[model samples]
Target: MGEWDLRRLRVLRAVDECGTVTGAAERLRLSPSAVSQQVSALARQLGAPMLEPYGRRVRLTPAARLVLRHAELVFGQLERAEAELAGYLHGEAGEVRVGAFATAIAGLLVPAIARLRESAPRLAVRVVEAEAAGAYGLLAAGEVDLALSLAVQPGGGDPRFVQSVLLSDPLDVALPPGHPLAGAPGLRLADLAAEPWIYGAAGPWREITLAACADAGFVPERAHTAADWTAILAMVGAGLGVALVPRLASARRGGGAVVRALPADLPTRRVVAAVRTGTQGTPPLRRVLDALAEVAATVQPD
Candidate 1:
């Protein structure tokens, strides 16, 4: 046996489908003799009988039937590959894995996904909820194409990645309903200093909470620790403690918690997108970045 010829296999499958050399040739726009010759070459290459004569036409031998079955799969896969390639070339489709914090996934990525589906229906986006540092780790490890992180990740001069500021997410205070500071017209971080705090899971957000409190001249008294904004808000609602929630995370403040803005000069986390240095120019990635920017634009930064 020699190397398999895809052309010969195609011809063999065509013959099996059409049930005759003449019919296969008509479908393939080749002479019946050429079709018969292709099938003979295929049989010779495989060292097996391809077709057996029937009453008037010809039928595929068991060996040929097996080859045709596999050939059909090959052809189908090639067709799919071609379609996907076309999508990549047009910037309308491809898989983009995004690693982002939970807050950004809800406020930014979720909205961007809706737009992407409408604008590039064939594009596929896989999102992973990760903290700032973890998201950057995944980006560096090649597990994710884009990472949405806070300034705490600090990719400033890293040669391995290109970090672009996506937005500035302001921190807000989540107080229990009817708490002393809830009635105040203008809230300052200092006002909540004496109250017990429900801090977020250890990461950039928790760091932000601590730093904000330190700037306000007191350390927060922690009564609860949670990774989820909802859980933190619920604890605050129960009067367990107050919490520092990002604007994006507390947009729909409820569960008996009242959200208040910090002073204009107070701290806000710089949300950013990080991609491999050379990947920013990729068509699909470019589209995803553009969509993220569009979504971020809608947020009113403090």
Candidate 2:
């Protein structure tokens, strides 16, 4: 086979995904004829048929499937090469932008950036305050190099990004200082079944709270819905209702709220750092990721 054109391979992959040259053209923002030309050229170069007519659509031939299986690996390797070359060209002097929630900014990114300043003086780190649910969008759009999020579960995540768990932040119950269970030991989620709850109006935290409550055999009567930790803790402190506060946010418990750990088996918010797939190996990104992991290791609930 002659030297394969990466562009043609990409076109073929798009056709395989879309199942039609017109669909692939729309996806690739090219004319259908151009899409067909690319795939045809690729097939000619490889001396095999790449696609076959299937009713009104098209399907990949056995040869095309075999080629795609290798093409995917080649594409991934090229991405890695580009990332590594960028790192090499920039040395250790490039900037790394990170998007994270407020608490993670205070608890993780801040400390990580501080460490990087000492260890990699030329590498600048920028932070954007983004919630977990929306952070991935920023990452996908290339607005951020790293995104600290809670939405990516262990063993399951978007294939387009590489996710690494920074820490599992346990959720503790926060109550008013004078609440009956303020100093209680051996507390469990079931024990709070009757108490009014304060949780996020929507988002992963809200889902987690509801799911944990349901697993405890009852639904919480939500007396207040607040997304900010400060507001939630404030409500708890005022005896309005109890709230499930993650350890990462416990540092700002403020006055009148008492935080207590629940049973060891309770759910924990998994804080993960995600980078664009194949970019994690770059020196600047690797350094920053290491710094984040180091900071996360020492993070303790206050």
Candidate 3:
């Protein structure tokens, strides 16, 4: 409690585990007397004895046991804090933690990463491929600095945080290559109303898709209740059924499926960037976000 060195906590825990001053000192690489002195100093600081005699070895006093439990937890957390801070200060091109949803990774984040590699060769951009709905959560908790997420309309997520709408890419229906709609000029959601579909209801995208269908006048016949667009499209490629997907689905090098635009009416989904509420827009994060925006701009809506 008196701003004692962390070593005092370690000495206490080691002695508790090893059950002897000599053994604890050996584990900590300190002399037995030093361990004794440190423990005694800690006891004096706390105004209580932290150890109890037990046969040839020593056991913890009730107070030592209680404090040691908390000490272990505190030390573990402190170690993590130290490592994260180390990564933060790590050289000129330190690691930047980023989190994004899966489709975003395939959509624009991969290109963003490539652009960052080309422009800032030294910056280590650490990416975590997490669910899009969870991306903002990661940013909120300080687990990540930036998040790439999706919303039906721009500026809808975390108004208290900074959001940059990168692209308003159109969503399209992906069908098997030889399917009847493959060569069609365009489609309306009602055009495929009778067709069984596959989708994930884990996020707003699910509700957005379903609500869009309702507005079109028919509830979708869910052929598959699944997550992960790759698997969803794989099911589509198998001709199992068709599903709605974003434009990036076309970026794949053919042979998978055909993406056809929705008829002139349906709203487009806005893909955006969400940075912490007040990042001060440092040059490093600014440069990274700019590179991200540049990548998003290149994503032509098919």
Q: Compute each candidate's TM-score over C-alphas.
A: 0.73, 0.68, 0.63
Q: What is the lDDT of candidate 2?
A: 0.86
Q: Which tens-of-lDDT digit does each residue in 1-302 have in candidate 2?
A: 76878899999999989999999999999999999999888888999999999999999999999999999999999998887666545545688899999999999999888887877777889999987778888999999998998854322457889988889888888988888888877788888899999988777788888887887889999999899988888888889999988888867887579998886547677888999889988878888899999999999443
Query: Could you report the Cα RMSD, in angstroms, for every candidate shown?
Result: 4.5, 17.4, 11.6
**Model 3's TM-score against the true structure:** 0.63
- The TM-score obtained by model 2 is 0.68
Task: lDDT winner between 1 and 3, please give it.
Answer: 1
| List of clashing residue pairs for candidate 3 | none
Clashes of 3: 0
Worst 10-residue lDDT window for candidate 2 reads 151-160
- Candidate 3 Cα misplacement greater than 4 A, ranges: 1-92, 152-159, 177-180, 252-256
Judged by whole-model lDDT over C-alpha atoms, candidate 1 comes out at: 0.87
Best-to-worst ranking by TM-score = 1, 2, 3
lDDT of each: 0.87, 0.86, 0.77
What's the C-alpha lDDT at position 81 in model 2? 80
Q: Show pairs that collide, candidate 2.
A: none
Q: Among these predicted structures, which one has the highest lDDT? A: 1
Tell me which residue pairs clash in candidate 1. none
